[model samples]
Target: MKIGILTSGGDCPGLNAIIRGVCKPAIQHYGMEVWGIQSGFRGLVDDNVVPLEEKVLSGLLNSAGTVLGTSRDMPFKRRFSASSEDKPSMMMKTIKKHGFDCIVCIGGNGTQDTAYQLSKLGVNVVTIPKTIDNDVEGTDVCYGFDSAVSIATDAIDRLHSTASAHQRVMVIEVMGHNAGWIALYSGMAGGGDIILIPELGYNIHNVGSKIIERLKQGKPYSIVVVAEGIKTMENKKAAQFIAEEIEYETGFETRETVLGYIQRGGIPTAYDRNLATRMGGFAAQLIEGKQYGQMVSLNGSTIMPVPLEKIAGKARLVNEDNDLIIQGKRMGICFG
Candidate 1:
């Protein structure tokens, strides 16, 4: 059988490793041909593809990003929902015309949703979940989460020394378009004095009081971890909230550092390397077993192939009652 693969959404670590996993099993075991589409769906739309072989998949098990390259140029573009029904049909036609017997897509929610639609159009598809945000549905852990949280945590850890020397309020901002997993986990791991997430909106009184208490406790320096998407009690964006909070509250010099795209690049963590490899090989196994339209997801410690529908329109947000949030609050970490 012939197979095709593509990566979509924002660039992430471990994407190339997943491709290696898929092509490894397909070629070594099933004698299948795999081709990679360049620049995501647009690659197919524009008929740009490169043949993938065992040799081509070599030495990328721990590499980051997609060798096939990627882009956000979806058939639906930013509409997300409006382009699904019709654009997916066109995508399937493009796949079939390219002579692919099956397709494996490795990406986050948007990519999986498109994979499901294309499968319904009679294209056999397998998906591997990959998101640094860890917000995709049905997966306890996604491939890039480990590396992202590691980078974020380490960034905060490094900031501690500088904050101490400068004796300033260092507000380190990490990526999280809507969720706070990165910020929360990094906060705990990096010994943040304040942890702010989108999940918990706090009043100025709450944030200011915590900073005041920390100052009273004689800690000259404070490390505050903030998710980029966090919101205020009044429901404004966290970046905006930070600006307002900085203007309204006073005591120490405030500085904000956005980790930005640095968190998405770099070598994959050992955990992500292994997870992507397992998920990739397992994805090829599923395709051979005739499991179409499924996404390989890690359920705690086990990898389970879930029907794409199970993840369609599904979002796994950080638990509102998670111990991290509750414990952070109790320990006097401000979430504003």
Candidate 2:
């Protein structure tokens, strides 16, 4: 079998590890030919590809970012073009020209939706979810989540010393547009005084009260961890808005730190590398079994295939009643 693989959407730490995981087994064990598609679906539309030899997959397990490259390009999405060009049709042509039996798409939510569309067009498709947000549906956890949470947690831990020395309220923001897994996990792990997630709405007054309460309890410093997508003023960023509001309400010095793309960079954590390897190997196994139109998903300790239709266009979001939240609240950690 000839399989074509591509990475899509935002780049993260575990991408190269998963690519290596897929290519190594498919080449050495299954005796299948593997091809690397460059720059996500754009590569398919543009017919940009290269043969993946065993040597090409070496030393990638600890690498950050993808060697195959990636993009936010969605061929299935409608584009207002002057020329009469159909991207999806062009992609199908490339698939047929290459004689690919199955295309293994490694990406997050948008990539899953596109893979499903390709399957509808009769192209064999299998996917592995890769996102630091941990929002891709039909999977208990995605590969890059562990790496990102580790980075964010480290950042929060470093801020603790400075916050204490200056006796200031430090507001740190982590990535999570539609979900709050990063902020919630890192905040609790890093011992944040207040945690704010997009899943639960927070009041400025409540945030202020939490800071004031911490001060009254002989805690001169406070750490506020917030998700980037948390509700704020129309044109302001979450951390900046919250920091300004906290300073205004309590008359305390407050500062903001946005841990933007830093959370998505660097070598993947050991947990993430293992998860990516498991997911990638499982995806190849599914292809070997001719289980097309499925995505490799992590369900507890097991890696299994989930139908593409079940997860396309869906996202796994943090809930208000998450166990960590309940435990944090019980421990008198404010959630605002």
Clashing pairs in 2: none
10 residues in a row with least lDDT, candidate 1: 76-85
Task: Give per-residue CA lDDT, model 2, range 16-82, as digits (tens).
Answer: 9999988888888889999999999999999999999999888999988899999999888865396
User: Quick one: how many clashes does candidate 2 have?
Assistant: 0
Candidate 1 lDDT, 199-269, residue by residue in tens: 77656667667777777899877788888886555875454556458537855677778888999998889
Error of 1 at 57 (Å): 1.2
Residue-pair clashes per prediction, in order, are: 0, 0
- Candidate 2, which segments miss by more than 4 Å at Cα? none
Off by over 4 Å in 1: 76-89, 232-244
Clashing pairs in 1: none
Best by TM-score: 2
